[model samples]
Target: MSLQHFMDTYALKLLQAIFVHLGYVVLCVAIGSAIALVLAVLLTRIPRFSKLIMPFLSILQTIPGIVFIGILYLYTGMRPITVMIALSVYAIFPVLKNAYSGILHVDEKYKEAAKGCGMSSWQTLFYVELPLATPSIFTGIRMTVIYLVSWTVLAAMIGQGGLGEFIYRGVGTNDNRLILMGAVPAAVMAIGLGALLDKLQKKLTPRGIRLQEQSESGQSSGKGGI
Candidate 1:
């Protein structure tokens, strides 16, 4: 088919698919981040269980996305909720691991200062630990967003609309153009979203940390020059 002809036929469908794909990405990331953050905080309070729970979550992450979605579909009957649940579960691991690690790694001095200021446990967590952990948490969020861009395509497997519809259809008919139509957009979406998250990470990071990093980088460059 001619390029113009293809566009005329599929442009509206493509737009719809992009919106559907974006909706899934946003909802899954939001739900997954909330769940992960809460769990990470709770685990911080009870460190002993983390050894067991973290490994279990890592195992869940090992499950292939297609297989997980397929299993959920079997049990949940091909519903949109099935896809959402699978995607959300998949989204949990990276954020959970990073957030847990980030909070744990916060310098003892900082925590001591917070305590010296008469901050409560909740206050220390909110006003100090989480802010310092923002960069790491945002890294997990970016990973989740990029993965969801591609993973949301699985929604098409059950007839919920997304760019994956074009990809799967193209594969069935051996049409490379159709596959590209789906794939190129998803790649672009991932890149664009990842960049946006990078910018957000910078904004959310503490100014002191950013300045320290910049200073360290400059000193390293000067040493190399010498």
Candidate 2:
């Protein structure tokens, strides 16, 4: 279809679907990150439980996306909320794993330094550990957004409309343009969001870590040059 015809036919509906898709992704990621971050923090506080829990979460991550969505829809019926719940659970794993790994790997000496400075356990966590973990945390968040953007299309399977609706219709009607209309925008959204998050991760990452890494690399090269 020509630009004019495509616009005349689908401009408004496409815009609406895009907005719906964005909303779904945003909401799911927010909820998932919050839940995962808390769980990660808890696991860090109680190391024994982490051994037991992390595997469960890893298993959850392995469940097929379509299977989870189908199961949720079966119970909740064809509602956007069902999609939201399913997607949010799927988004939780990366953030949780990163958060757990980042916090757990904080140097014991730095943690002791925090304690020596009169910081309590939680204070040490918030001020020192989390700051050090910012890069990892943000990386997880970026992954969540990208995953959600691609997966939101699945929402249309149960009648919760998004770009998936167009893609589904296009497939059924054998219209390639409609499929592209849905797929191309989704790809753009994923790429755009991923780029934005990359920038965000850089900004949130501690400047000291970057500088230290750069200095370490320089010293390594200087030694090797001899």
Sum up the clashes in candidate 1: 0
Global Cα RMSD, each model? 1.5, 1.8
* Model 1 regions lying over 4 Å from their true place: 221-226
Clashes of each: 0, 0
lDDT for every model? 0.92, 0.91
Off by over 4 Å in 2: 1-3, 220-226
CA-RMSD of model 2: 1.8
Compared with the true structure, what per-residue lDDT tens digits does model 1 show for residues 15-86?
999989999999999999999999999999799999999999999899898889888888898788998999
Q: Output the TM-score of candidate 1.
A: 0.94
Cα error of candidate 2 at position 218, Å: 4.0
Model 1 lDDT vs. the true structure?
0.92
Name the top TM-score candidate. 1
Task: Give the distance in Å from residue 211's predicted Cα in candidate 1 to where it truly belongs.
Answer: 1.5
